[model samples]
Structures are given as C-alpha cells and as structure tokens.
Target: MLKREDSAVSKPEIQKVGKYDVKEELGHGAMAVVYRGYDPFINREVAIKITDTDRGNDKDSAAHRRRLFFNEARIAAMLDHPNIIHVHDAGIEGSYCYLVMEYVKGAKTLKEFNKKNEILPVEKVIEIIFKCCKALDYAHSMGVVHRDIKPSNIMMTSDMDVKIGDFSIAQIISAEVTQIGGIIGSPKYMSPEQVKEEEITSQTDLFSLGSVMYELLAHVVPFDSENVSSLVFKIVNETPLPVSHYNKDIPEELEQIVQKAMAKDPRNRYPRGLDFAADLSKVYRNLKRPVVDIKEQAKFEQMKKLNFFRGFFDSELTEVIRAGAWEQYGVGEHIITEGDIDDSFYVIISGDVLVKKGDKAIVALKPGDCFGEMGYLAKTQRTADIVSLTPVSLIKVSGTLIEKMTVHCQLRFNRIFLRTLIARLSKTSEELAKYRPL
Candidate 1:
C-alpha cells in the first residue's frame, strides 16, 4: 500500500525522533510506521521508520520486536545499491527506536501496479524487475537475504525509479543464526522452500521476485487463497497459470523467464540474481523501447504525410513503416556509392542530398524526395553516388524486408516505383535534348 502525506490518518503524529523532526505519517506496515521527517543539521528531508511495539505481549516479545527492527537497520546499512533504499541513521530513544532513510516524495509501491484492470506496461514491469535483480544480487553478495521480497516492499519514485525497501525479515548469512524455523515473509510471494520452512538461499529472493513480476504483468498473484493454509499448500505443491493465460500480449519468451524464476525447486530457478538480471536485460533490448517507439511513430506519421504515400492505404503504409529502418547521415556522408550492387532505397525525412556521377553533381534531393529506386526495384548496381548535402534523416528499406510485405503492398510499391522511374527518365530525356550537339 502507498500512503501519501495528504492521506495520512490525521491522528496525532510523533513530533520528533532524535535529531529529526517528523512532518507527517507517510505509511504504516504491520511492524513499523514510516514518517516524513526533516533533518535539522543537514537540512534535508528524510523518511523515518519507527518500530510498532504496542503489539508486543510480554518482555520477551518486545525484545524480539526490537531485535527485528535492529536487524533490519544493520542489514539495510550494509547495502550500498542504488535500487536498495539507503539507510542514513538508526538509534533508540526511550521506548521508540527509529531509522532515518532517504525520503522519496510521491513514491508509490509496486502493489499499485498490480491492479487487476490497470496493470503496468510490460516494459516498465521488466525494468522494475531488472533493477530488483541487481539490487538482490548486491545484497546476496554481501551475505544478506531479503527474505520478504514482495510488491509492497518495492517503492517506485515519481520518475518511475525503483527502490527496494523493507529489510525487516532479512537474514544475514555471515551472522550467527539468532532466528530460524518459524515461517517468515509474505506467504503469497514466498518460494516453495520458504513455504516448507526449509533452509533459504539467494534463490529464495528470485522466487519472490518472480511472484512480484507475475502480479505486475498479469494483474494477479501466482498463488491466492482465503486462508494461509491453502496458500502455503498451493505454493509448495501447485503450478501457477502461465502468465500468457492472463495477458496474451506478454511474449512467450518473457513467460518462460518468469516460469523458470518461480520454479518449485530452487535447482530449477536462476542460479543467481545476476542470471535473472541478464535475462531481463535481454528482454529489455528486444522489446520496443519507449524512446525508440516515440521516434519511430514520428517517422511513421511523417511517412504518412508524404506525397509518395498519398495513395497508399493505412494498412499498406503500416507495412511500409514496419519494413523501413531509420538512419541518419552527416553532411558530406555518402549514402550510396556509384557501381555498388545493393538493393535498398532511401527516402529523405529531412535535409538534402546530392546525387553525383563521375565527380559531376547530378541533382539535389530534399525532404520527401527519394533516390536508389532503380537499384531497389531492378536489383542492379547503383548508377550514382548519393551524399548528404546537410545532416539528414533517411528511411532505408532493405530488399529482404520489402520481400516480406503483403502482395497488395508490394504491388502498390512497385506501381509507385515505376511511375517515379518514368518521371525521372522523362526529365533525363529533356536534359539530353537541351544538351544536343550544337
């Protein structure tokens, strides 16, 4: 759950904790309350996490809770990853123990992205998981296991940067085992080993991360039940519905990645967090990146407005858009050289290019103009050199991609090429007549 400063319960809040002054309640989890705080000496805003001790029944329970809070502070302080939340200070004052952390205003948790009807975009989800994987890798290298890796513990900044928070249940492998056997972590996101209360490892974090990714992409938890018993039973014995069953748009490759991460046996899951991150990075590179997509759409729209495509249907234009690759050339850069045997064409989106033959400037082509049609359509050697007269944006269409176009689109393209060829030949004849032997 994400609680903004404005939506705080309006109850009387803590005025101060050590050197920091509390501004308001930011959020509250079962074990602690997070507060918006201001550090006076540093004049910086911070988040303060205070342990909730009211739930402790006796002296032993209260000490156990305190130990848990201190354990979190120690574990979090040891981590120095960008994705992992930074711990600034921790101290105990009377009955209250608090930790000062880096504050992220307007921050939301991954839980918000898991809404049934409003899941996050697949790319965004992949990026979040990728970051989490690296963060976990760093923590694991430091001999720490964030036993409770779940959506609510992963915070998202206003700019969509991920911050993996809440290490209250973390286990430091190098430290003496003070707590064990008792079940820990959220049941819904737990690994099969966690459900069975078996010895946990770095692989446990990957399993929980897989659950978080699944919820974000498919808008449903991998294992859900009305009671803890059934939930634990399912996690230990059942297989989750393939993510594609819930969201078909999710690629099969991505589904397989998620499945392997959430495998029932630790041996089947990624060997390390770095391995998981590597797979996510591959998906990131292959997916239509947001920045690239925006630029491509702009090119597509420009293509639609050109006279060359005026007669083309929307479907045909879309095919062309998919077939073409955008490229840029600097002034004096050669696009096509004379006598080159390449079957590709170019259309100028911006700037100008000079068509040259035997060191003679033939003609200058500007925006919306095309060259190399003869080479592309006839599969012959280039007759001239096309060099950029100014910095240029060009759409390059390869013969291979064009060959994959639908029959109707290919026919339309061929007709336009023929018309363009005739027009150029006619102009050449007129020039030849003007230059006839005098």
Candidate 2:
C-alpha cells in the first residue's frame, strides 16, 4: 500500500465503500484520503477519495466540514475535458463520503519532473499547456474557478498526457464564502489578488499557469527564497528575471508571452485562456524555423572575458576561436573513452562532463575546463573516459589542427602547449591521490 503519510494505516485496514474494495492508499491531503480500489460491480480499478470527518469538533460539527469536501467532488464531476480527470461517482458510506474518479497509471506530478532537472523542449511545453488552456476554458464556461493551481495538482502520465487534479480549493462562482484569510491555495502559485485575499478571476489561473511554464523552461521558480516571509514578499512585490536570462535557447516571443501572463496587473495579462493558448501556438510555429547562429556569437563574447587570451593579438585569438567546433552530448554519453586513440583536446563551453577511471568518477569539468590535454601533449591513448553529467557543449580542437597551428607558429605553440600539459598533469595527480588508499 502506498500512503502519502507514513503514519497512516495501510489500505486493507480501510473499510470498504459500496462495491469498491480498497487495494492501496495512494495519498492523503488536509481534507481527504485518496486510495486505489477495485470496483467489483464495474470489474475495473478506480481511485477513491474518502473525506476526513474528524477534522473539526463544534456545533457546526463534522457534517459541516464534510460539506466542503463534497463540494469539491461536485465541482469536479461537472468538468468534462480530456485534460481533466473524470469523476465517476460520489456517495457517503457511514462516516466517510467518498468520490470515485479515473485511475491514471504511472502518472507523476510536475514537482517530480523538476527533481530530474530536465529542460523541456519548447514545442512539448506548448503542447502540454495547450491542453491545460482548453480544460480551464471549459471549466470557466461552467462557472467554476480553480483557486488552487500548482505543480503538484497537475499530473503528467507515462505517455505524456496531462491531467489536472485536486479541485479542493475550487470556487463555484455562486457560493458564499464565510472564512476570511482562510488562504485556501498553494502560496507559490497564488496570484497577487489571491495573496491579498481579494476576489479572484480566470486571470488568476492564467498567472499560475505562467509560473509553471516558467519553471519548466528555466528549471527555477520565478521568485526564490529560503524563508516563508521573504518568499511571500518577493511573490507579491518583486518581478522575476526574464526567462531568456537563464535559458538563452527560449524563443523571444515565448519569453514575452510568459512575461505578459505573469504581469502583476490582471488587466495587463492575457484576457482569457484562449488568448494565452493562441500566443503559445504562434511561438511554437516560429520555433520550428532554423535557429540563428547566436550561440557561436556568445562563445566569442565569452572568449573576450578570458584573462589567458587577453594579451593575445586579435588575429591570433580569432584564428583559435575559428578553429574550434561545437559538440553536444547527453548525460552519460562518452565524449572520450579511455584507451581510445584520439588527438583532440576539449574545452568545455557549457554544462559538465565527468572524468571517469573505470566505473568511478574522478572529477567533473565545468565551463572553461579542458580535457584530453595529456593525450594531446604525449600523442597517446586517452587516460580516462570523459562522459557528460548533463547535456554538454564543448569546443574541440583536433590533433591535426593543433599540429598545423604549431607548424605555423612553433615558438608560441611550444610555450602555451607545454604549460597547459604540465598544469593538467599536476591537477590529475592531485585528484588521483584523494581516491588512493592511505
């Protein structure tokens, strides 16, 4: 049995409801317990959400508290969209009111995806959010507003199907609320109005959706803080850095859309879900075109900052930059295998590469770090496997290119090459000593 909280009893201990027999406890929230159950009548599996009745003890009593749980079920049952999880039934058995919903196997939340630190392709992100937009539009048309929209509430299945779940904080537009400062939603995804405890609109949902997209692209939250007070202050008053600042690969049009969606003023943001989806579609189309050579230009800009190359003549530095070629590799993909005959030394342009001797990793190479220098100097087989730890980009200078350059300018090449080789060997020896037995 999979329980959200470790202290909760296993699913078999939970009493059966109607024809459904609990198989496993999937998760538990503030107001309900979600379980994987077998529906004997239907001869299939379903997710059963059981409301927590012992939440409050007053004249209003447990029944009054249970009504809010049922309200969430009622609102979810009315939402019919491919991206929305369908509610099958809702009923009370003794003290528990349970709602039966569709069971999606092998589904993970956006929070789980972030743990992997993957930078999603722009097209795929747009596709996922397009489905979310349609679902929100449909929910809005039915006069329902999802007050809580966060990464944990959105599920991505194995086949990449997006499903929105957890409608507990949803407002029915017609309902009269009594609790002020109840603060019913996730803080990180809340819009400015929600933070201030003001009336919320469809624009609030769009604001949350934009935050999710921003995180997917940049691998960081819009406003980051370690403490609760600082986090709240930044979310309410501070503006996030432009997405392009972190990830240069993001299309400019897409960046603009994210910025507009997260605009502090609701009026400045997209008016409706449809408008947001339309902008994303347009950006997707533009992204399919050939990318300009901006990355190469960035490399030259970086070279200008290097102190080692500062004293070199412009023509010499330009020649060295022109001789380099960009190479990319997936994590664990071997850029250079130990004992292989190779004459090229690599300068890491971005990301990290792991230097491995046998099955153990020796060290990681960050931007500006060079590898295979020992081989280049000695003209021998590679001493270690250089594998990518993340998606990596490097500038490769082939043995033949170095040879040609050395032939043209022997004195300069000898001075620089010998110094680089000696430094690399010294570092390698120091690293090896750390791993050696005392």
Candidate 3:
C-alpha cells in the first residue's frame, strides 16, 4: 500500500502506524483508504487499510465499527491459501482501525482489464475462473461465504495468477451469525437465494462465481436491469444468454459448467466449489478440439479478409484454390515437420496451428494465415514443424501442382503468386521480430 496526503491543508496527513510508515494512497473504498506502507519491524513493504474516522462521531459508535472491521479481519486471517491475500496485523491506532495485508505488486482489477480488452481468450478466462473456484472451495470448507464475488474483487497478476480480495461482505456460515432475510452483496452477481434473502450457503458463492466467470468469458453481465427492483427480479427469475451465445468459440462443456453453476435453484447447481472446479478441469481438456467447423467457402472468405492478401485478384486466387486440397487434423497432430523432405505449402482454413522449433511454438496461425510457402518456393525441407493447436482444417498445395500451374498458367499468375509469397514472408518476419532479442 502506498499513501500520499493531499496538498490541501484541510485534509489530515496520514501518520505512521506503529512500525509501518505510510507512503501513498493505493485505493479508497466505502469505509477505508488503503495505502502502500513500509513495515520496519518486518523490514519489508505491506498494504495498510485504514478506516476513515470522519464517517462516525463519538467513541462508542467508532468502537462498534472497529470491532466489526476487526471481526472480519480475524476470520480472514484464520484462512491461509495462496490465492487469498494474507493478513499480517490488525489494531486500533488513535481513532482509526487499520489492517496490514500482503503487498501484491503489478496487479490489476478484472474491470480495468476489460475496459482495455473487452473480451479475453476463452482459455485464459477458464484458467482464472478455475483458480477462483479452488480458492472459494477452500474458503467454503472453513464455513465462509464471500458474499461479494465480482470482477472488481478479483485481482490478476501479470503472470495470470488470480487473487480474490475485498472480503468485507464475507459471511461466516455459523448458525449463530447467519442473518436471515438480509440481502448483502453486489446485486449483479447475487445468487437467486441471496436476492430472495434466503439462507446463504456454499451454493450462493458458486452462483456468484458463475456470474463472474460469465462476465469474464462474454464481456457482459449475466443479468442486466434498469433499476434495483428489476435487477433482483431478474436474478431470481431469469436465465442469462448462454456463454456460447456471445462467444460461439466457447466449448459446450465449459458453457454447461457455467450454466449449472448459475442454476436458479441451488439444488440444481454445483453442490460445492470443488464440483465446479472439477467440471472446469474437464472443460480444459475438451478445449483442445474444434468448437465448430469451418467450411471451405468460409475459409476462403476469411482469407480474403486478411491484410496480407489485399489486392489479390480472384483469377489468381481461383488457381490456388483449384490446386489446394482441404485436410483436417486432430488436436496435437503434426501437419508438417522441420527438415522433412516435403515441398508442400499450407494455408489455415480453420482452427489454430502452431509453427514450432521442436516442441515450442514460435508462432500461432489462425484462419487465413499461410505456412511452408518459403520452403515450397526454395524447393527445400520445412524450416519448422506445423502442429495443430486445436483440431484444424488446412488447404494443402503440393509442389507438383505449383510446378504444373507455373507451366500451364500465364506468366501473370506466376508473378502474382511470387508477390503473394513475398508478402507472407514479410508478415512472418515482422511477427518473429517481436520475439527477437533486444
């Protein structure tokens, strides 16, 4: 946490709390201001969350709030998991109750990430949500329900590790503390039971997790409302557009897991967070196959959309299409090999292929991209292995066909082919430059 006081004289300059010195304000929430601070006792940096005293008057009212705040901290501190932020210390200093927590560097809220890239890849979305499921499962086993689970509460590091934060609304599932008929959580992510003010269970968290996963995959909330009343009504009554509806690329197995996790009836949903995680793991395995087919005509149309293929005449393209043979590959199948004695070129028709040096992918080829053309032109062995990342469809053109076309077709077609080959080589060179050493 970093804390910095405003230059305005009216505001209080944040003072040192015990052995920790406040640096600059990291963020502000409804009840507290989080700051970056250096802990002299530990000889390391940590985040300090300080409650604002301005919100309440009198010592008794302040004391009650402090007790409630520390109570939440005490519950959080008891749980130890890698995905959960560790709480170091919590105490009252003067009028403010402050909590010292682990300092995670280079983290961004999922909301901030979505504002920049509206949608993320399905693989990445699944990976993050799976981690959240495991963390939530661990918390649930300890009789804790994170009442609020949303994009804003999820922090993702640069390496793609996910941490669920802001446990202010977390409810202990003990019968003595469980509050009936009390709605507590963000409405957008609220489970049907939560909206109805029913008993909060582990299932409630699963529903919220589903909503977060839905937003991550689709880039839209599962339920939308013009007002709070309508929002609550929808949460209890409505079913969102299937994850596949927004992004057809999402596999059926994944879509099914999300749908089941978000079921309107708690009984119909995943019984525990582990169940949800297990389903997601299955989806991860299924994601290796093609989600949908890419027809030959669709492949051609996609190719025409590529920038590298600009200004290519239909007559020239027709010859290439005539010589090409469509081939389907299973996931992990090798379409070509490095140093293989084959003079065949290929163009991606559907799915994804990886050009690799041995086992490592040097480049990924989506629809419209061409590969092995340079080798075909030089009449030499492949420089890299082309392996299918997903179940793939490619248009393979043999060297013999190209030689025949060169002999039979006019020189204009040959000139066009040479130019197209050069254009593809230029694009590949530019892509390879990104991985080159500085």
Name model 1 segments beyond 4 Å from true: 1-12, 52-57, 116-118, 289-438
The sequence of per-residue lDDT tens digits that candidate 2 reaches over residues 240-344 is 999888888888888999999899899999887877876665465446433224455576777666543455566665566655555667787888898875456
Q: Highest TM-score, which number?
A: 1
- For all predicted structures, in order, the TM-scores are 0.65, 0.61, 0.63
Sort order, TM-score high to low: 1, 3, 2
Winner on TM-score between 2 and 3 is: 3
Candidate 1 accuracy as TM-score: 0.65
- Please report the candidate that would top lDDT against the real structure: 1
Candidate number with the higher TM-score (1 or 2): 1
lDDT of 1 by residue, 131-195 (tens): 79878988999999999999989999998888999888899885876753378778999998988
Error of 2 at 406 (Å): 68
As for lDDT, the candidate ahead, 1 or 3, is 1
lDDT comparing candidate 2 with the true structure: 0.74
